[model samples]
Target: MTDDTTIEIEEVGGHRVDADRLRDLLTENARIREIFADSDVAGLRVLGPQVPVRDQDGPPFTATVVDATGNVAATVRGDLDRPDAFEVASTAVVPNPTHEELRGALEVLHADERYAPFAGRDDVIVYQPMPPTSDVEQDDGTVVRRITLGIFDPDGSPVHRFVAVDLRDRLVDWDLHGVEHLDDHDCEDHLPVGVGGLPGGDTGLGQVRVRVVKGGQELWSFTVVRPRDSAPTHLGKGSGVELRQVRYRGRLVLWQAHVPILNVLYDDGVTYRDWQNSETQFQAVGSDPVGPGWRVCSGPPATILESGTDVGNFQGVAFWYDDGELQIVSEMQAGWYRYISEWRLRDDGTIQPRFGFAGTRNPRTCMRHQHHVYWRLDFDIEGAGRDIIEQRGLILPGQPVWHRIVRETKRIRSPFAREWRVLDADSGRGYRITPGAADSSADAYGVADLWFLRYRGTELDDGVGVVGGPPSATQVKLDQYLTGESIDRTDVVVWYAGHFLHDEEHPSPHQGHVVGPELRPVRW
Candidate 1:
């Protein structure tokens, strides 16, 4: 080991030179070394320290280094703040390989005999950092990172193979389909085994697990079950929507396409709901082996005609119209019931949440029932503190329907029957929850539109029924949070309930029906 106190300087070309010391200094500082290496520079030569005595607590020292051609390369600055610190800072251009270069490299890799089967086939190749796992242990202090190139067939079949690279060692590993482990020491041997699919049958969907690793430690992991149909649902070919984690307006915005809770009450005194909790009865999206019934829909974006003015379109914009709608559909009761849940993200930062039931009615004739769908929105608005809820109601005068927006806002200290808004004072951003389209008849509680309550971590007992349990249960945990606790400038949760009544007179459409609320942003 080189002593930190020793300073070596070699006079080269009549100029004091210390190339080895400069390289050692650059390598000791991780950030500066990364910049130097990434810049594709050949080598660096230290000219000399700015000060004669090499003061330990003096200002930063500047040294000039020459590139491979012996020409002046860069002027590096080193801060001698600590006796053992050799921190270097420099301005160097680290040019990343272009997409064409990456594609060319993939083409060359596909030419290998191991990847020949996937060559010349229309495929989707995704590159991502492999997470940390026990399979690859890094004991040498060399930061071991892996990048995975997942290759999928043209029809969006399962990932054909995972081509990985050990960045630190510059080694390559490939797991090809139908091939056993090529090497006994392969990382595949130590990879974590994920749940294949539904316990009993194939769901036509496949699972892909990726781990995000940093410094040989797993930081995060994600598992994505391949959809039966890869195309967007709005195209009408499928109903599976890909919910992406996005950062909107400097805030992390994530969405879940399906909410497991769906309650169906029949007029014949039977209720069906707890499918999510039932191990034997729970069916995943593509569980139906024969002609997978579940589908996701990315509905065509429609123009928002609010207040008779054509606001910017919802979903995403194109040339003429916008594209919207994120939907998922799954069947239960052996195709007797098809449940469709949809979430539409608008360009205006509003979310339109809706779900409905369709498919053939049950064998029981004259089946009149109501479907209540509840959503659990765990909002961490502006970092999740000091949030308040307010209810707004329209006060209509006698025979006078105010054309203008006539609504009252009140702090919700307890469970309230009105439209609500969750506001964050720090960010000045708020969300208003309103009911979707509903029938003229009033609900069982007379307030079918929405409900407001504080957040109790354990509100849902076992995910048996909706958040509020059955109507008969006295302690409806959903309303239990509304114990008159002041929700003013406090962390709270607002639960919105929406229902659709299916009667013998008018049945659900052959396709299905959609109903839910529009979550609009207030002063965001």
Candidate 2:
């Protein structure tokens, strides 16, 4: 040994040294060499004892040291491999890769440092896999069943169960669709909630801090500041209308509605009334004033019409001078109503129904089609003088169809466009008429086929919009119709069976005379 304190030579100048002293010198040299190698750049030289072999080599000594720049200076050992170890020690201080880059490369493996001790002594290094726990339970006591993340181990078993975390609540929950895992920092305090740690002892699994917001029975809930600690702000505003559930991008939004009218377009001043409210308030509706839409009408005790009651009380009447006689046409529960009586025009020009049925069925009431009775008058009437009645035919429960038949008049218009003749004419060629466009002279003088189809429509009180869809004719514009202005549209709905679309060539249906809101079908 070179140092006097480490010298154990009993006989100097070719004498044996003490084994303990030699061992002590070698250990000191190794420590000094390692420190110097870590700090050096250019190099320095170190001297130490080398392992002795029985059949040995030329020299039996080792030396390793480094320069100031952390570069290996030189190594003089009997074995050449000793220099390589010295070089590795010197080059160990290379620049460290960024944490982000390292994490990217190792995230899949869950290669995160559980314990990184001071450098040089790495015996206590520990690594943990990502997503450290599974079988997480929710506040409602339901176990999370799905996860969108995967787990991995470092040494032995590489697979482990992980639970999805609720970001809002900061709680771990299982999800089958995705594997859920945590960042290294979040796993610090998190403990394994399930079984199976290491075999010998409890694995030093850490715990994670999670502030979970408990769930409630409400459809929608969010955090809100209350007088005390923060509380949940529920979306359901007192539950006027209870819905099983609703979603917006898979998130529930609960709201309440109590008023009958729901204003959809406050900017445009448009609103919608609930169907229930409309039904309750207006049990009976009548022809649209301002042209041809149905108006809520209440008369004859405005309740739902009973089986044998008069719907006539719900409608209006139109009068005309017919062959020096006064005539009236209207509708009631019994169907259509028509009244005719001799007229003596008073000098004062006052008009009245003289000795006529309060309400009577109009010309066409029942039709024998395929030997089946189809109620076609269950519809609404509209326009100047209400045209044909339109209705949704639901006689067959399984299938709903639409039907419109023109009401034949005692005096019907001629197809030739020349004149009006008796409906029971020489040929009874029941002509079709369409509400003429106000500006078109040709149509103003006579009706057209296309206009007839457009003018009549059958709609039912379906929950949404109209059951049979919008009327055939372009619906009377809201602005024009509401303002009492005439638009090109002139479709009317009325209550009459088979009077909606009549074929003069086909035999007429059972026509009837005016009685009272009751139909007394008469074969014409």
Candidate 2 error regions (>4 Å) = 1-428, 437-524
- Window of ten residues with lowest summed lDDT in model 2: 228-237
TM-score of each: 0.41, 0.13
Error of 2 at 125 (Å): 89
Model 1 CA deviation exceeding 4 Å by range:
1-247, 252-260, 276-335, 395-418, 439-442, 445-449, 460-477, 508-512
State residue 15's C-alpha deviation in candidate 2, in Å. 99
Each prediction's Cα lDDT score? 0.37, 0.21
Give candidate 2's whole-model lDDT. Answer: 0.21
Candidate 1: worst-modelled 10 consecutive residues by lDDT: 186-195
**Residue-level lDDT tens digits of model 2 in 77-157:** 333434233222222111111123223322322222321221233221212122111224558643432112223222223
Predicted structure 1, TM vs. truth: 0.41
Candidate 2 lDDT at 406 equals 52
lDDT of 1 by residue, 480-517 (tens): 34466655565554445556677656765522356766
Best by lDDT: 1
